[model samples]
Target chain A: MKNNFYRAVYCSRCELIGSPETITAELQSILATSRRNNRPAGLTGALLFANNCFAQTLEGEREAVERCFERIQIDPRHSDVTVLEFGPAVERDFTEWSMAFVGDPSATSPDPLAVALFKDIFADNHADSGAKVLLLLRQLVHQEDLWAIA
Target chain B: MNQISSQPPIQTDDQNIARSVIRTTTSDQAAALRESFLVIEDGAILLDARLRVMLCNIPATIRLGHYGAPPSRGYPLTKLIAHSSALDADARTTVLDRCSAMSASDLAGIEARLVFGDIVIRIRRLALGRLLLWVPASRAAGESSLHDPLTGLGNRRVFQAALAAIFTKPNASAALLMIDLDRFKQVNDTLGHPVGDALLRLVGQRLRACLSQEDVVVRLGGDEFAVLLQHLDGVDALGKRLIDLLSRPYLVEGHLANIGASIGIAVAPSDAHDPSTLMRHADLALYDAKAAGRHCIRFFKSELNARAQARLALETDLRRATALNQFALYYQPLVDIASGRVTEFEALLRWQHPSRGIVSPAEFIPLAEELGLIVPIGEWVLRHACRTAATWPADVRVAVNVSPMQFSDSKRLICAVADALTTSGLPGSRLEIEITESVLMHNNAETLETLHALRALGVSIAMDDFGTGYSSLSQLRSFPFDKVKIDRSFVSQIDGKGGSGREVVRAIAALGSNLGMTVTVEGIETDAQADFVETSGGHQMQGYLISHPVPSDMVSALFSPQSPIASAPNPEPVAPAGSRRLRGHDHEK
Candidate 1:
């Protein structure tokens, strides 16, 4: 039997406390660590930080994806972590990047689109919000050339 | 204040700020230092030289509230300790005196450790006249180790503790309820874990809503919960209410999920005095509730325990009986209606326990199935029956009954059949495999593939105990069975009253014949039943009216060339009653 490919999306309240610069540094370190870990595990995904919330999607073999998600759930920097979607998928949407990050944490003003999408995710308590997050991530990654593909 | 700044700075970055805040004694610097402490996961509180609260984080405020001494900026530490309901008067005075008497040297390390009920608070001195107090996150979150994170209910540890506490008081009247959710696995498998988790949380909320605060409810594990009821007066009503409430549909994560609860109740000091015994009794009753069907409740009884003990002994005997070769197969003849000749014999397993004599298949077959011994036993029956039938006339086929468990692994079953045929040197055409509708209910594709493979080997398939299970007609339409055996229930219902039972039998026989399948009416204990079956278009009849299932050695004697049954094509039907005592006659004995 072929290995089942899965994608999981979750949003959590960002518990990291500090000035914007400190939080930006923390987010950059998170992106770097995720890239280093995800490549060896055959995982590819994107992370978004805006409005004091973090939404991320991980896509890989089912077991690897679930293991990475479990680790993220226990990380002290995130709380109220809610999984939006977790199931077998036909194909990977973020295949080019091991960990693609979409938000400028150091910027004085948060990205309006990312912040709006995060607001909608928190406001809507339905399963479709996970799909909406995936669509938003796919669109943001395609629209912006600033994100590093590592 | 300037004296603190002149001293050597702490090695850690955050601690350096702690030293500076104490030296400068500036409100702005203190606020920045408090902002840095927010990054720490533990609850943090800063105290001034007078041991008054200066700054606190959100976690610290929450923890303080839990200890019944909510903190505020500028609040005196002694007053906070005095206000705590968690601490007795002596503990409060001890904590206050310890804090007030701390020397400048003592402020450089952990100054005081205070226990308030289950919560512990640790005080550390950051600098001269500056102390930091905080609670570790693990111990601070309402003692999270004793709670289930998803539902906010107590965990198994809490259940054990509560049970132990109840038993500590002699003559305490309490009831334990073991609840298991039905169809929960289906939802988890189909909807994914998020929805399943959400459903569990909703179930927890509903359970809490049904009972009073005095009753303790805990999520024991996945889809299993336990409730400790202090009052036993309305325990039955509460169980019923729980069943009704849990059975209601739940909308979880945009999906509508339906599930049910089965509860088993055991009361303390009456059913059992010890925690382990009470738990076992509740679990046994839970098994009974589940076996009785979902959404039901059962109470512990002494007879249930006796029955459980008996079953354990029987299971042990069955395991040994299989190894000791204590099982035998009795053959029952199926007579052709038109020619009144025995064309086939169905193989039936009988267990002869050493001391118990003959054990009914009705009692042991289910146990064997549950124990997963049916596969090997079923194979043995096939091989043995084929070996016996190899000596019979070439045209008389032998039928062997197959349990649904045997079909779980189609490859093993097919291999067993092929092996039996090859080893016995019996032709596949001389063997028939009998199965019930349950064999086709699950893994339909695999079962069908196995059936086709068996047919390829030239063995016929028969649907046994037909019209008993649901969707018998649909099952017949799904596959082209060579024979359909009408269950004995309808045959026994034929009292010559021309009721629906007679009509049902006639309709099934007609339906079977119309489908080009042979119909065999079983359990015909009288002439009337046999006559009804013959006139109802049944092709074959097998029942007590012909003869009781006889040993393998006696099967051939009944149909030998010299016997009256073999010489006469339409011989007299065997006596319906007391046929077991009429063993002298060679034919129809």
Candidate 2:
């Protein structure tokens, strides 16, 4: 078989809207569908809900990753979807799960990275906002508190 | 007493009948409430909807006797308490207006304290139009305990309790004002706490005078006060007024002192509904107000919270900025007009934030200073710029800005600069350290000594942003600076026909030359501006007209053979005494 696919990592941030019950239900459904859909496409990543915002990193074939992001941009449960980073990666950052979840779906405990990311996004002085946001997400994974099995 | 003497006392048999009637008709809970009301030593009374006195304990009868006759069943409650002088006028009106507006089923409650001469009576309007009044047994003790002994203001405990009571009501709209007095510690440290105590008392008195009677003010321990204003829509103007009022000079024990207050206002039903959240929000606003240079009012907003969180995030990122190798140095050339060649390059700091792309120094420099990260970052920039500039043609000097904060510890900065020069194999004379006027404003021995030592090491010292500082000429005379960069403001206005801006630049350039120093005019863009600098005796010029700040990799081309600086022929062969030639280096070619 000819190796014809290139892997890319794409991350985006969005504000989660709706009540806790609705948001949790929506998140659960999203995870279920994302896992079911991404497994066949070999896409894997983690979704973090904190401070009413989501930071997700998806790694897979470049075409599949871009397509997944296209669907997420129009998702009704969230708004202000901003792609912080998108590029080829040597390997998967979230290889264990297709759609891992960090932080509670109901938005109970504050997402530590959300505050950091929001600051960078809205900063008047800082430049290279997207890369700083990616670093913040990478920090979350390194911290190990944000990881969900699947 | 006169009214009590006129009216007949309640018959003992009538009281017994009323108690037995209450015991037979009311449930165990009601009976228990009535029994407890009877046994309390403090004055106790219960009134019905029609102002009828349904029950009065012995203490209540004795207390009521002062204003009117002892109350009995069917006696009008309002008439009995009409003569009391201690009921606050404002509270009286509020209770009366609210009582008429409320419906029969509405279970609204009101708390008020009525002072009966030496005693304080606590009154609460309960459900079913029942009015409960009781004098706290330890009223004197309670008053003292609730107040700060030093300032005589309600203490933190009292404020918290008041907040809790206010939170229980539905649709309560108010503003929580958090106040912090600036420079109180300095007063305390220098003049001592006794004077500080007096100043605090004065602050409380001024604060109390500015507020309405209904507003509750509490001293939240150590130069902090919280004021809870009921039914207030916005407190911005009021907060300003309070800050102005509190900031006035105070005479504490024959010593004149000054202080200012920063206020943060958080509104109810908007910022937060609960007490703790409201307090936190108010405190957060206070932090912003203080950060914005104190002595001002800041209202809590979602954006303010976001900005504060962003600031915190930036601080974290700044700590890691150097560690992650996210910082870079950009170079902008400084061209000697006479020679039409690059004399030196200014190394500007840039943060290539992983997400933010290229963070401006304007935004992160101050933040890094606040986080105490500037020293290390400055060290990194110094070393990196020096090392990079070392690879350039030897004649091209590299100038790096030294922040005042970095220069604050002159020893460490001097050591770092020395280390950088030694490690990069760059001659001390090839490096220029640009310092603003504020850096020399301190004029301390250590800072001056540091400058002299660097000069002794053959490093060129430049007074940056001249004509903008407090003492430019006197400072020039005071220190042997090798160069002076006329500020960009004066340079931009040089083309403004016969403007003082041009005159100032000309005079500064003349002074630089007279003092045996090279003058570099900054921010020269237009030809008219460049001509003004050239004719005005400005030795060197730097700005976008030459070239915008570029990455480190692009710096060498500006000095390369056949480059802009290399191609422009020198109009005059006049070189300063030190004579650092730009294009004469044949070794690098």
Candidate 3:
């Protein structure tokens, strides 16, 4: 695909209604399924799981991206599904990570964007939520690498 | 001549052929330069015009693998280096453009920098493609910029990196100590920056000596040092030792300079796990230590954050209160002992916070002073008091407390006072400026001159909260005053038993009389307290026993001779649970 292709970036947070192992199992399966389903569809994104919540950002062709979110919204493994941000972008922020995963069981450190999004979607006193979410996901990806190594 | 011309032409032709041969050799040498870059310490990656990694040296491959997965030949450079979040959207765009179709003139000599943790990658366009050199961020400082120049201790950046490393180590529990030097500014002001610098070096050395070999000491800029302790049993004994060692007097450039250290500690895994949050919590604890009177130590507790948030909320509210004109002055009648009548009304600050109803001045004044909001707030209080007291009887003076910060700039204070008096048309005699002994402790000749000038303007000055601080006697002798208010501490202790409190009160009153100054005894909350003040030769009595501070509208009624409450013989309850009397505005430090 050409680099100038338009894509939709969407982030949602939902409560993980299962044990840490079960969540981990479900996440691994999701990653397996996503990489399989997204490679031909030209989709790329990242998934971050801290505490008992899941924050995922999806970027792809607008229709394909929306279709993927539809499956996630109906998934029984999670509850309290709420979309934090949805918008059209010039390019994909997570082009390299087709399905990067971050799962921190002792995730006591607060994520500024996650807190704001969960509390109120429109209560972003900071103007640029999309950029902040992108950076936050990127940080989570780095942290996930560290967690894997540990 | 013909033969020479033929030789010159032949030489010219040979010279041209030699130049062409030299050019071919130089081109061959240019192709060999690529392999020579492999030995450099920095990571090197050479790319083709199509943006594929053509060559990745050993260091570059290691760094790429460190970030994520290493790239092989023909792999995209962007994908290989996309693991770091610090290279945000703009950097990504520039990297791609410089590799592809960006004009040579656009990016001609400029190199794009991508910072990933401690590694800084410099990307510049080569003749055919792009070259990226990844060097350690500290290379600009010759590889060891982690230590502070003045103290030879690690700088803040090193401390932060160490904190991060601790968090990554499994089962590692450490304590972060944030220590700040107290009265260091005074040393600098009195001695000089060179002396101050020497004192800092001495403090750093002492801190180092107090720590174990495993502990990392960092000079976090300007009298603030942070220590990370590992494999420690408890931080209490170490904290005590640090305080003692840091508080000792230091010989700096032949001058003995004294400074104290306040430490705030946060234990890892309990208080916080992350470096920034841990540092912040320790800093909050440091603030608490400073608040609890310097030269102390405090450990981080969950409640500290809530208290800090509460303070932040109050600070925001105070700024709004000033803007909305929500502050008012209450007048406590300073009455004559013999006449049983109000002589002066001490104007006390009262903040009508929108929701909290009445926020105590004791709670907000120091905060305001710290926030640098006191000057404007003080100006408002002075003008409001002068304007309100202008309506009162001319004989009843109005006393307004002035903070030391306000007096720092004597010109501004003088102008404010002059403006208030001039605009209100209130005689300077009816305006009294109440100042504590600490205000005069600076002993600045200019401050004394400012005081004398204020006195010369016919305005009365009272030595407020007297006998509560050092140099009370010396201040009384050095500065001219129209009145002296015995601090509430001594008055609260006075009774018929007559101990040091009564003796001290008697001596102060006698001294005030001897100097031809009116003496006002404060905190007289009972009949016995009032009687003690009268018998002890007090000229005026100011306390709840006389009259609780009433708002401006009630001032006229209190000062009226016909009003029975003004001179009530049996005073009401001194301090009801919710009475304003309990919210006395005491100076904090």
lDDT of each residue in A1-150, candidate 2, tens digit only = 123233332333444567877777777888899999999988888776767666677777766775566456435465444445555566666667787777665546766657776666545423465556556656666678634433
Specify the highest-lDDT model's number.
1
TM-score for chain B of all predictions: 0.69, 0.64, 0.70
What is the lDDT for B343 in model 1? 77
Is candidate 1 or 3 superior in DockQ? 1
Give a tens-digit lDDT track for model 1, residues B175-224. Answer: 99999999999899789999899889888987877776456788998999
Residue lDDT tens for model 2, B333-432? 8887777777689999989997989988899998888877889988998899989988777688999888888878888998999999999988999899
RMSD of each: 19.4, 26.0, 26.5
> What TM-score should be assigned to candidate 1?
0.57
Clashing residue pairs in candidate 3, if any? Answer: none
True-contact fraction in model 1 equals 0.00
- Stretches > 4 Å off in candidate 1: A1-150, B1-153, B168-171, B182-201, B251-259, B291-294, B560-589
| iRMSD of prediction 2 | 29.1
Ranking by lDDT: 1, 2, 3
Q: In angstroms, how far off is B456's CA in candidate 1?
A: 2.8
Kindly list the per-residue Cα lDDT of model 3 for residues A42-129, writing each as its tens digit: 7788876654566677777655665566455445455544444555566777767777766564455755556664455335333455
